[model samples]
Structures are given as structure tokens and as C-alpha cells.
Target: MVKSGKTKKKYHKPTKPHHHLNPPPAQANKPISVKTLPAHLVLEILYRTPVKSLVRFKSVSKSWFALINHPTFIKMHLDFNTSKNDKNKLICSCGYGTFIDIALLSLSEEPMNVLRINKDFTERPNYPRKINFRDFSKNMVLAGSVNGIVCLSHSEEMSERFVVLWNPSICCWCPIALVETKSWDNMSVGIGFDEVINDYKVICIVPEFRFEDYGWSRIEVYSTNQGSWEDVDKKGKIHFRPNTDLNHCNFIVNGVPYWAGLDLRPGYVDVLGRIDPFTGLFKKIEHPKHVRNEITRVNPVKLRESVAALIQSPGDYPNNVIDLYLLDENTTKWTKMYSIGPLVSGNVCEEMQIPQCFSTGEIILETWTWDTDQDHVTDLDLVHNIYDPKTKLVLHINHMQALHPCWYESYSHVESLVCIKGMVQIGKEHRDKKTKPKMKNWTEFLSKEFDSVLHL
Candidate 1:
């Protein structure tokens, strides 16, 4: 009885309510602190990123957005990508009607393929269709591309011609004021950037009409910084005939525009004219000796910081040879760097159009071929040949089979964050004022179809 009583007497303290008590500290998990990188270091890393990545990264933060959109950052990114040879997408336009198809070509892959299709700029639904045939030709000419901006004219001969500066990368466009010109004129327009003024310029060359024949050209320039067109002085006007093939003949190299120049007069050699973007003045440079006599086509391309010309000529039976000449800016001399074959057998390339050249010495050639016996152009053999200068190996890519080459027009484009409206703000805006409405109708239709399939 005594033992039982002693054991039962032991009592526990009453439990207390701890409702207002403080919680235990977060278990020694690593202390959370955001370690922001230095601004310059962050910018250096962003500059090395791809343009598409940069565009998407704009949503990261306010500071990141501002850094990506800064002019200095944009230029630094461009220069960095250019140095790395990362900005080498070829944009090609095919077919002309109510809608056009613009395909982005990727040569970075082993077998080049279409990277993306941009129908937004091609489908100019707001454009007036009542324009005349001549006007239509001028508007759809696809003058050329420079630093991701493309220039298009609507009226070449009229006093008031409508022009568009479009940046396909951002899907933004600006219509330039009507460009005024003289009567009975043939005009060639080229757009380029001026590093000196840090502005974009448009060069218009109208050949003088002399007794129903082409003669000395009158040059006019439009500066985006000034937002007006001005006449180039007589000294700045070139005497040679402008190349009719503006798409292939005109190119921008190191912020200057180069065009294939020809003098119909006897003993006058064909030259490459370099137009100064700031002053509108031009200087003629001699062509390489080998391709001077039998030049079928001349493509001026960017080679390093200077310029290079791709010259093509007919070779032995069922073959063609392409020669690449680089210009020494100091001496103004042409030095031959590469000589691509007498292409492979059975592949007769009639017209060789070079869209781009990589710093790795790879040349992307777009060619059109014809049947030897039929003497007519054949669309079956539309191919893009990538020639490696070091190995002299050619990789044939059948572009026609994939893109159905209907009036193929290709240009080398470097993707950029440049705003067309920023460059030409005086003109009407082409970008939609608001974001495009979500495809509600299509989404609903697809959902209903899926439900029906599930029930079935």
C-alpha cells in the first residue's frame, strides 16, 4: 500500500497555451541575399548573347530592359556579334502578290535550311493596291538591306515617291516622306548607316536622260538625322552608269555604299564606286584584273573591316569559276584571296548570287541553273552552294525543293534591335498602334475540334 501511494503521487505540470509565442528561426538554411553583378560585367555578358535571346531578356527587369535598348549597348552587341560572325542569317523574298513569303536562311547548319518565315512584313495589307504598274515595280524592288533595315520605294520616277524603312527583326516600319526627283529618270536607291554622324542615310542615283540614252547620274541623299532629302553637289555625282541590277550590285560595307559602276565609253574600265554616307561623295576603285574582262556578276560583300567583291565568270564545259577579291583600303588595291572552282560536274550554275560570306572563309552562293539542251531556265536546280575557301569543298543545298524558288530575292541581314521609327520619325508609322488581338476564333475552333475527337 505504501509503494502504490508513493508512485501515484507524482504529478506533471499543467500544459500552457503558446498561441502568442515566436516561431523558431528558419533552420540555418543558407542566408538568402541577391548578389547583383557589376553593370559593366553584366553588359559584357549580354553583348555576347544572341539577338533573339537579348530580345526575350528584355522582360527580365527594368535595368536589363534599359541596358538592352541602349544605343551604346545595341552598337556594342552588333560589333560583338559581327566580330564573332554570329549575325549571318540570309533573308530571301519569294513571290509577289497580295502577300509575299520572306524566308530566313540558316547557313550555320551543315545543310543550310530555312530558319524562320516572316510573313508580317511581306503581307502589306494596308498598302494601296491602286498604284500603277511602274509604281508597283518601284515599291516591290527590295532595294537592299543594311544593318537589319530594308529600303523600299513605291514610285521611282515621280516627284513624290513613297519609301519604307523596315526592320524585320522587330517587325517595325516607318514610311519616309515622298522623295522628289527630276522628270524622265531611272533611280537606284541604297540605304546605309553613317558612323561619323551616327545616322542612317539613303542614297538615290538618278541617271541623266540624254537624247533617250543613259548618261552621267544625279545623286540625292536623304539623312535620317535631318529627316529631309538633299541634292548631292556636282562633285559628288558619279559619271559612270549605275548598275541596273540594284539588288545584286549595291551593298553596304563599313557604313559606305558600293555599287558596280560601268562606263559605256571606249577604253573606260569598269569600277566599283564607294559612296560616302556623310558627304554623298563617291570614289571609284578598280576591279580585279582576272575578272575584269569577263565579269558576269559582281557582289560586293563585307570582308573583315574592309570590303570584298565576289566575281563570277563562265568556265569550261558545264562549270563556272568564282573569284573573291579583297580591297586594301589604304592602297585602294584589290588582292585576290580565293578562287572557287569550276563548280562540280552536272551542276551548271547560270547565275551566281552570293548572299553572304563568313569570317571563317565560307561563301554562300545562291545559283540558278538551266538545261543545256533546252536553253531555258530550269527551276528544278535552284541550289545554294556553301564553298569553304580553306578546303575548297562545296556543299550543295537544294533550296528550290524546300522554298519553291518563285522570283527568289535574297539579302544578307544582321538581326538588330534598331527601331525604324527612331531612325525616321517624320514619316507615318507602319507598326500597329496596339498589340495584335489574340487568335480567339482559331483557339476556340481548335478546342471544339479536339473535344469532338475526344468524344468520338
Candidate 2:
């Protein structure tokens, strides 16, 4: 070794590793970067996700925000959800005599399959996720539900009735012009979609009250696209009734609303009434001959694409079968589809104390026992049963009893993005910031599922 005046260079190791050893394998459990995913694939995964999850993802990036908010994407999401039976739900109102709580029941495909897979019925489905209605309305009637939008009508007896179109999935509401109810009674409210106009419309069929006026309902329609209400029918020919229960499905067919009402003519005739969504015109339909002579009340329900009647067979008090008759819209006649016997015999759809066969082909029977005198409901006993058409067996889901009035009625619901255009301001969560629970600073970065990495 030679020693020079200059300091010797410090020894250092080379960065290149030996060729004998291979680099450690990439982490097997590592998450894939969203950047690596094609935008179309990312969209495919996202639109199928639950709405709650999608809401949180809006802050991800500008491209994501645009994609999620696009009208085409929203429609695609709604279509995908509707196509999947498991994604269907029912918006319900339940309470005792006084207070009603709105809840969402998961009408899953699995439960229907359970009737086949589990013969013993040991397995129970997890359903009926509870949602608070206090934020929405109190004592308001659920006028109708369409594509996840609920029409909430609040009317004091003999006063003005206001209607609100609420999309619970997105927690946004659009209020329609109020209907002056001081001059109207026996109002029938319905909500449906209009494919021709590509808009959602809410209709109110109410009879104008006058000293000399006979009982005939006038048709008024509120178009969401217009954001205004228009009285379409002035002839006052037919009258339909609402504000009773969650059986509103009995009134709507193929986005058209129908009701069993009276036609005001020389002599009052019981007629099946419907409102043409496109024309906003009122028309009268006749009851099936099988149901007309029976003297038993019939339920006008949406069957396939037309209106159908569920008629009790023979006599009402003592009956052995119930017939389902489909309507030939063009002929204005009824054709018998099938007869439900022994399994669903002697039951009326609205007496509601008896079993009712729905267009979904399930015979559902719900019973409620209320403890009341002159005041509010103190306690309740509710039992719900389902009759499987295929198996011809009735499943007594359970006999549930609860304190306080817990009477709940479920209406048709679909998970959708409608009524959410430029209107997704966070609901109670953002409105009640002071009441929100205190979360850790670090936890804010984590995704809702906790499986996600820090968003920021």
C-alpha cells in the first residue's frame, strides 16, 4: 500500500445486487392501482357498487367526478340495478297509531330462492335495513314510489295538500305546487315515468267539490321536467281514491295509473279508471265479467304491461279460489291468467286482513294487531307471510310483536339515480354537522370499508 498526501477514498458498496439472487417477488396481497385499470373497467366496477360507496368516491379525481355525474352513467347505473333482482327494495312506513318510521326492506332474490334451497327454513335472510324518516316527513302519506323516488303528500283534512318528490337513495327532494284541497276530496295520487317525454310525472285525481257538482275526479299532472303542475282533465268523469296503504302497486301499470272508481253519468257505474301519462287524459275501463257479478271487491293491479284484476271466486264470505284476470288493453276486456286455490283461497287484496297475490307472483299476507281505544297506538303485533307459487307453500316468516304502533306498509322501490341531477347535496349527514360523531383525524383518510388506503 502506498500512502499519498491526499486522503484515501472511502470504501462504498455498489447498488447493483448479485446476479445469483432474484429480486423479491412483488407483494402478493398488494392492492392494484386504479390508474392501472382501464377507465371502462373502473366504470363497470363502480356503477354496480352501492350508492353510499359511490357518493364517497366522487372526491377521488376530476375524471371520476365527471364520469359519475354524467347523465349517461347515471342511467346506466339505474338500468344495471333494475336488471339485478337482488338490488330491488321496498320503501315502507311503519309505526304504531301515531308515529311512522320510514324503512327500506331488501327484497332480495335469495329469499325467494330460500324457499327452494332451504326446505327446513332454518336460514333467515337479513333484511329490512332501518332508515330514519324524521328528516323527511311526519304523518305524510307515501303517495307513490317510482325508480327510487317517493312522493310524499302531506295534507291536513280540508286544507291545502303539498307534494314532495323525494329520491331517498340520493337524499334530495323537489316540491311540487300545492293542490288546494278545500274544494277537492277523494283524491287519488300516483307517480310514474313517461317514456315519450322522458320525464317523471305525479298525478292527482281529485273530485272538485261544489254544491251542484257530482262526484267526479279531475286530473292534474305535475311534470318534473317542467317543475310545475297542470290541470289536464276538466270533464270530471272518474274518481279514484288513495291515502290508505302501501298497496299503491295495485294502481300503476306500465307507467300508467289505474283505479277502481265510479263514472259520473246518467247513472253511477263502477269502472276501472286510468290516466294516460302522455296525453294526461282520463279514461274509464270496465271490470272483468268474472269480477263484476261476484259482488266482491277487486284489486286493480299492474300485471305485465297491462292492468289486471284479482277477483275472489264465487262468494266472498265462503270462497275456495281467487282468480287473476289480465286485461286486454285494446279490447278493454279481461282474460283469466290463473286461479289460486287452497293456498290463497278466500282472501281479498285490500281487506288486507287476508292473503293478497301480487303481480310479482308472490302471495303476501300481512296482519296487524293494534292496542288502541280513543288515543294513540300503545302496542302492536304484526305477522307477515308469503305464499310461494312454485312450491305452493306458505312461509310464515315470523310473528313479530312490538311496543308502540308499528304498522308498516311497503311500496315498490328501485335503486336509481333519477331525481338526482344536479341535486345530490348530502342529507342529514351534512345538514347536521354539529350532531355528527367525532371521528379521528387519521380515520378521515380511510375509505368507508377500511380496506381502502388513504384517499389523499
Q: Write the per-residue lDDT of candidate 2 for residues 321-391, one digit (tens) a residue.
A: 56778888888878887765533322222223332234355655554545554555666556666656678
lDDT for every model?
0.62, 0.57
Model 1: per-residue Cα lDDT over 1-456, one tens digit each = 545544557688999967746544763455769987655566678777767688889888655565566566677777776666655665666544444555666654432332223223344443564332222333355556777777665433332455567776665566565544444245676777787778887777777777645557767777888877765565544577776655333566766777776765554557777778877777778776663334466677765456888877734434467778888888998888777877645634366677666545567777766555465555545666678776789886655345555535455567777774344322233434567676433323323332232231
Off by over 4 Å in 2: 1-35, 107-136, 155-159, 179-186, 231-250, 266-268, 291-295, 303-306, 343-360, 367-382, 399-409, 420-456
Best by lDDT: 1
Candidate 2 residue 322 C-alpha distance from true site, Å: 1.9
Total backbone clashes of candidate 1, pairs 3 or more residues apart or in separate chains: 0
Worst 10 residues of 1 by lDDT: 110-119
- Could you say which candidate leads in TM-score? 1
